[model samples]
Target chain A: MSPIATAALAKTAPPAPPRRRARSGPPTRRLMAPATLFLLAWMIVPLAMTLYYSVRHYNLMMPELRNFVGATNYKLLLTDPTFWHSLVNTLVLVMACLAITVALGLGLALLFNRTFPGRGVARTLAISPFFVMPVVTGLIWKNMLFHPVYGLLAWLARELGLAPFDWLAQQPMLSIVIMIAWEWTPFALLILLTGLQSLPEDQIEAARLDGAGRWQEFRHIVVPHLGQVLYVVVMLESIFFLTSFAEIYATTSGGPGTATTNLPYYIYQNAFFQYDIGLSSAAAVGAVVLANVFSFFLIRFVAGNLNAGSAR
Target chain B: MAIVELKNVVKNYGGRKAQGPNAVDDFNLTTRDGEFVVLVGPSGCGKTTTMRMIAGLEDLSAGSIRIGGRDVSDVAPRDRDIAMVFQSYALYPHMTVFGNMAFALRLKKLPQAEIEKRVREAARMLDIEHLLERKPRALSGGQRQRVALGRAIVRQPQVFLMDEPLSNLDAKLRVETRAQIIKLHRSLGVTTFYVTHDQVEAMTMGQRIVVMLDGNVQQIATPHELYAQPVNTFVAGFIGTPSMNFLPATVGDDARSLQGEGYRFRAGDARAAGLAGKAGATVLVGVRPEHLKWCGSGDAQAANHLAGKVDVVEPLGSTTMVQVDVGGQRITAQLDSAIAVEMGQPIALTCAADVLHLFDAQTGQALGLPAQA
Candidate 1:
């Protein structure tokens, strides 16, 4: 039949069974020992702890007898009006921040793409915001810039003889959005600028020779080339905005009575301020799921466009 | 149809004086309506720069360019009504071949039917109708080049500028596409300005060839004129395949002869007028390899006969190129393949004095000759 069977039949019968080969190197236990130890201590242990805390009525105030309360924490989080308001707030802030940042970043990128006087300095200043620490950005915006009476806006208003208004108290969400946009616009600008720079110069020249006006070139060449970079910028900005806690904490402290209380801030409030570990873990998991959903949609859209463009 | 003219066009890159040579210096050319002119030189000789200036892609430092008798020096490239086929093909990567050809018309907001009609006609002319639906990236190199030409044809610009368009193709494809481009130019009857470094292309395609060197036009003439009578040593060496060989010579009272170690050849009365007052002066004698014949096969006692030893022999199917060490200097002679000449054999070669090119050794300027009839 088979070649292996023929080879076996040709071999003489041995008095003793053929010696089995032993593995020469370190055994399975030794090979996996370090990785298993690391996983147990770092990943699995924390995940198990989170799961244990998530399914029990656990709080710092009541730790004597932890009672199993399956789905209670999740139900409470889902039904909580404050939780829903925070989720809406987070969505609005993320959407507003992403839209404003992408628009401003693309505009700046286009502006910097041209050769003009001081272009080098202008580009360096435009990207400087990305290097600023988020907390510092928030502080600078909150105290030195957007502060009602003594900040830059107030000083300008006083000079103009207009009444100064409290920015944070009057519009907490808007204030936070403006601050976040300033910090993230440079990120978008860097990516979009690279995209613009990498675009084929000859194709643009060809379009010009083909009688394409400035607007037509933008629509057909520049915009299509920037599409992928725009997607990446939006996706990354959304993820950062969804999990934004330090900016809000350092600036508004989720003040003005839940006006700036996004999901991450709410989770922070439950875990550290209210000491409701189970509720906070549930909310954290929810945030992760929502981020994944948005990321999935963005990636799918980018992939579809890439495939369509490539196919053409 | 339109005539194109470049008047005193100068392009200078402002920087350190030692940065390099000027890209283009005070260039001028005029192409009559329906004329095919090819600009040819080594790379960095400013041929492409001159074409780009004509296309309005590069602003002239100081000059006026006119198309159809209208000054277009300051006009935008699109408004100049000139289409350029770039060396890279420069096809829009995102568009289909049909779209690439129709882009200019679409930009002009031409109606769909009119755009389609013009695009289809151009595609038919370039024989790329079957590839209209495919994107440029999917097409072969030659196909892509045809698409580029089709794009230009659809515009029907006054002048078509091509910058080494066939250089990217393989050897065989270049030949095939060269013929196609020449035919296309003839059929369109557009004033086409082509820039290339390949002399064969310049010779075969253009009605007139402009030979450029060091940012200056050396000579402008028909292919036959350029090959038969180059204005200077540069043009002579640059234009021909297996370029004309130059040997130092001395002009005497009655006869001019190149005297190397064991070789001396008489320059007869053909070049006597150009060398009248230059007796005993050192000069360069240029002879095309094909013009020289083995002595025994031809007349050995001819006036322009030089004896030498054959150092190398390269036999092509139809001809043999024998490198002869004449007076310690190597000179090439093209002979019939039937010649039974072997390496190291002493031989004698003769050239017609009328075919000999004599040049001043100091200036490297051609000393002899009226333009060939």
Candidate 2:
């Protein structure tokens, strides 16, 4: 209406528009700073150094000579017959050990799920092997159990009127696989048993009322319920199995040839025995990549199971 | 449909010192085909244990259970041809609603089309057809219970066993779902045995209500029968809201009159004949709160009368409950809401002689009613 009234209203309304206040601080920086710093110092630095050394011709034996090698170590390792043989041996051992441990672990988990007379004592004994140190486990199996003449195997064979055979020499890889499975099966059993115990009791009763026999119950209800936990056990066990060096060193020492030289043992041989830092770094980088690939698949499977379970 | 018979069944929890009461002692029931029977009791009354035994989920320590005239004491739960709805609505979390309902058929290796047909039919009956594709976690609690009911219905077993299935719902939903369940039972006309500690549910839902206390059946009768004529002191005290009031009295003069402190009641001809020759013996005079009325003035037609002062008055919208102190004992009276009775007012109440229940104080048994009457 009037110019003076308009001016007064505008003056009373406010001055120049107030600046919009910031809506708290950026949350990512606040939450992730410590983890970011840790990864930078511990993981990223070492990984970058390994990647650099993997392509460079830098040997501990010839420290003054450094040159860009451009994947020469990978080429050499891929072409080497010994490395190929060790790789094949490692794959076989890992798969066989995993299969045996999973089967035995599932059986034990089911057995212990029932109410028996001494179930508590039996469960405590079942989980004991997982607590033993890896080096001690390797030594116990090698020196006191599988030693050619003095160990339990040879002693038992002699008692049976059979010739005592050399275990490490005749079957180095198989013996190592057996030793690793013995040590790790308890881990799988512990996790899977917890899963089995945590299963909803009402579902089982409902299945029984639905006329499901014991076999059907196990196949349809129990196994599907255990899928997520089983994935966790397999992933954790695989990580430990991939880096299995203490056992190999204590028992076979990658011996009899390159028969038992898995990736970790191969890296150890290159760095400590052959004094070839470049080849060792390359192998270590390759092992890390392989482990990541395995873990990716495992995490995806576990995530899918969790999603399905929650959807229910 | 099949009738379920539990003959002299007993379950013992194995007492710690060999002297404790049995969990379920000499329990017996015979449920007719197409009838709805409810077992009602307080906690630790062994009602659920009895239901579990009938379902073959629990073993009977004594006696036998028969379904369809065939003994099933040694049968497994799967072979019992009975379906149960648990209080928790134990739907398989990993299975869709359709799968949950179809699981038994799937186990029987029924054709896929047949399984689907049965599942859809049950879902339609439950009005949960739209939820068939969803898992249990995706449904609300009432919907999940419907799914559980659907699962049981799909089986078409000889009997349906429900253990406090509506206890998990909110009060309003419980009432709504309760009516739905009763309607469902009537239409299906399958023999059903339901267990609940809620007396209201038992009274409203069952064709016959079995009242239990301390693992023993106190009374089994229709709702009207239980309320109008309870068998003993416990049943009289338990079956009604505010319960029947018991006052100690002495029977005298050929049991034609009962005398207590500050009160005397003349037994009518019918009750007098049934209770004669019990003079000087202690008995319990049971009167429902709703049956007592203010006498207003002395009258010869009043069979029983007691002088008292009102101590509390509670108006419950439709009715008023008045608690009065009479001769060192307090008694409650239910009155119509229109009465403007005030606290601390002196009043006299009278109870009709025929409505009074006489129980032997020592035996806790009704003095005159014959067994099975």
Candidate 3:
């Protein structure tokens, strides 16, 4: 408490060291330059060419009749009824698949989180659908599961004294949603299960002692603990679902009067079948903008989930 | 407030009827109403497991637990009306301090005003009122520990079970919180069962301390009784710092004296009476470090004295500790700091016969009536 001792302590204190610069900065950047340049050239150059072609009246069949047509392709894409129908179908597919996969994945993950006699094998089997190629997933559902006369579901319905129902012919959008949900539910399950496993056991026991029932524990503790993980799952799955193509190509083929035709298939129809490269490129650019818009809204809305448990 | 009892409690990690060793075996204790009992033992000694069984977080394999004279063996943990504080201070990471403390009250569907009042009072008691809106991750370790304590205190349950709650705290904080817990127990007067492997914490906080070893209860006594009248060599060695020194010895043919490697001492009247028919029996002479005193190294063969070459000398502020090698066995003596000594020098030490503790060499059981008894 004396001034002399305080002055002596101040005299004995060491000076703070200066902050040092990172040593390997320039060399590391130089080493990474080749990959960076390659990514930029591949990604940005193609996007630029697509934007250029979208503003011109270019048709593959008439290769010599090219002309500047600013905003024409975009106006046509916006006003076309089939384009709007495909856009609506794409939104519905993404939303339906997300809801189905998330609900089913959480339910199954909670069930398989417990120990059982063959849990390892069960989990392996549960996630096997994620490994099946999208094309193959479509084929299996179409030929072996959903065919009205001979597929498994039809056979089961007939055996149960119920009328066999045609899936693709009557409910094409529903069939597409089911096929995508089947393939992607496993992805959600794998990530959500890992999140569930990281929850501390003592927290659960503490909740039990706090007089919380099962529902309360899930709502208050487990769900909040999985908040960040669920945000990641939803974001990643949304990007993949927005670009879904192969499953629809194999099963419904955008049939039933464009009921299951999404944005990707519409672009394919314009570029390959109709041979309108300008229209296809415009739709492709619109798809990119839509994806960005969806991600922007998603990040804004659910971004709070990421900061739910973060410290001050 | 209620009396809590464990009757023949057994817990086996192995499935029932598997014939494997129980993690806790035949453990039984009955606490007085509003008693603060501490279960202290080494790791893997089932002290926490016993507390968990009482809290109904663990199931009893063969017996029942009773709180307030009602069997709660089949009751759920929440229904048993007990609150537990875990070693890791399992505060909900997402919840603020107020939410953490108000959780149990909210689950009971109490009035909003009552819950608010209780949480505020508990937070004030714990001195964490300023942190009510902050999450657990935002708080320091000591603050988080206070939040955990506040969570339990706000419940006002019939019993409190704490599983090594102070183990995660730093040394100074642990001591401060240890005293805080004792003070809280005094004011709240709830039946509490605290588990810790630290002997000092058990000694300082518990009204009755249960010492366990390898799933078995070794002794149950108050702090002073556990210190001065330990039931066996384990309790004596465990309860003291630097522990009681065990020197192998033999009962003399006269049945009144004990002869060790380099010393012979006549037993006191009570010890002699306890050893009346055990002449020539092999026993371990236990003496606390502080009980031994340095005498002049004049007569090596004198009665009631030990001579040995000093191995190490540690000079504490008030008392010095000297480790001496006698007949190839090392023993430590707490001596006065004024006594100057160095390594490799011969020294003589003596102690009163009443300070000597005799235990069976093979069984390690104390040989006479306990000191307090």
Candidate 4:
């Protein structure tokens, strides 16, 4: 283009409005640097120490002698019968708690979505369990509700003309699961109920006008509408459930021959009670890898579910 | 087709003894088989509540609604065999157009072939056959509208209830879709009860329009009757664009003249037949902007002209609207754009002696209509 043409175009283009200078990226990056570095250090330090300790035999009992034993700690942990037992116990506990909380939570959410007298008070009471501290929840169940001889169950059994049953000793894993599910069910209710409320009233009304009964509406409309919400609930609850520790610690403490010892409890037992730092670190590393695997699979599954839901 | 009737239906929200007023009170109307009736009002006037009553979505508090001579006040909406098109269209987002349209038939346990045939026929009728496999979220607003109509059509219901179904569309689409719906209505000939707040919709689509205010029926009349001779001030003011202008007036004590805000008309200039004996009583004089003509020639009808300064001239392509101030009262005068007019142009507008309406001031009931033989 000629300079004359450029000048003519510039003149006729109304001289583009004065632009305000935007903040450059360097200042923003500088502002974020400290917090980002701190978080990175906070996460990396413990993880690096765990890795280093897992490879070397360092016990508080004999701190002067520490030497690298390549793959020995991992092989020992993998071959231990107690480790396999606790892994099974962990699976059973996680699955059972998820089933109980999700099923019961769905039922309660449905019931609470209806309008009735005192419904607000009832819903608040139903959600109160989620607010209870996990340790408090554990003790409330262990001492006041599940005591073998003098708990609420024992008293009730005596009043009913039956012998008292030792609940925790007989079913240690079952007791832990029940306690966890009770604490988490309200979390599920809070999420699922919100999903139910946001379901369009027009769709429900249209279904009713389409001659669908209550069960059909639930099966076709409400269930599908709540699908993504329930998926999120399950994923979140599963992540929390897999690492559950406080309830078991307060109640079972890996008692009765490791019956309630999930991975977290077992790791604590090896490190604190058994004084085997190498074995505990190895077990902790195993748990972390397994959790990452589970999370990866769950995220992929939910992504697929999301795509299928919207693709149609 | 079924005739729909509502007999003094009442709906009160919350509870019966709740402090709030009733939403609908003692409403009554009857529609013949294949009749198109529209309930029109401002928002919160209970037009929607009244239509819901007819569809059996809301239970009447005191009165009974009958369809085809059977009492259905207590019936369920589904059992009443009525189809409704909601303003949101309410299509199942997860389902394809065919599935949404065929949902009711599938619920009735119809055979697969029959459901397929009926859904296809309806889809073709709505000209949405190509969109049958697409979900509602994938369709445009106009396509979803057709799907909604097809859903209602496949049911072959006894009555069609539409609650502001076209209010969501842009203006051009709304007009086009409205014409299509009227054509479909003519072909189907099903009794339809439509509710809208747009007076134009009520005027153009309904065989008879029911104007409502404060949950009470103000007037139920044909569009022609409603435009020509509104029974009261509310109906008169509501039924037109550039709405009918009202002026404070009184019958002169001598009974030969009409004294108004800015001008007086002698006995020969203004003829109010029904207001003959109401001498010395204050009345409201209503005049449509179209009836007020610009006085241009020496032979102008000057005896009944309103003189004012033009405040604003609004060009409306075929015509122009000029807001005029006469004394302390403001009124609009619609005139031909060909008749040149500009801002601050002082002018006089007149019409024939019979083109004036007299309404009682307090009650607002029409005393006499203009030019009624």
Compare the candidates by DockQ and give the number of the best one: 3
Highest TM-score model number: 3
Q: Write the per-residue lDDT of candidate 1 for residues B1-373, one digit (tens) a residue.
A: 7998888887777644424566887788888899999999999899998998888888777778999999999999989898999999989777789988888888888999999999999888888999998888899999999999999999988999999999999999999999998898888899999999999999999999999988888888999988877878999899887888888888776545555555556765666667877877878888899998877835655777778899999999899999999888888889999998999999998877778787889988777677455
Candidate 4 lDDT, A148-264, residue by residue in tens: 776999899999999887778988988899899999999999999999999999888888888888987887788878888988998999889889999999988877788999999
Question: Which segments of model 4 are wrong by more than 4 Å?
Answer: A1-35, A296-312, B18-20, B252-257, B264-271, B297-303, B353-355, B369-373
What is each model's TM-score for chain A?
0.83, 0.85, 0.89, 0.88
Worst 10 residues of 2 chain A by lDDT: A17-26
Can you give the DockQ of every candidate in the order shown?
0.43, 0.40, 0.48, 0.44
**Which scores greater on DockQ, model 3 or model 4?**
3
The digit string of per-residue lDDT tens for model 3 on B244-298 reads: 9889888988987888788777777666666778888888888899999999856
**In order of the candidates, what TM-score does chain B achieve?**
0.95, 0.94, 0.96, 0.94
Lowest lDDT block of 10, candidate 1 chain B? B13-22
lDDT per model vs. reference: 0.86, 0.86, 0.90, 0.86
True contacts kept of 1: 0.63
Q: What is the lDDT of residue B271 in candidate 4?
A: 45
- What TM-scores do the predictions have? 0.89, 0.90, 0.94, 0.91
Better of 1 and 4 by TM-score: 4
* TM-score (C-alpha, index-matched) for candidate 1: 0.89
The number of the candidate with the highest lDDT is 3
Q: Which segments of candidate 3 are over 4 A away from where they belong?
A: A1-28, A303-312, B298-303, B370-373
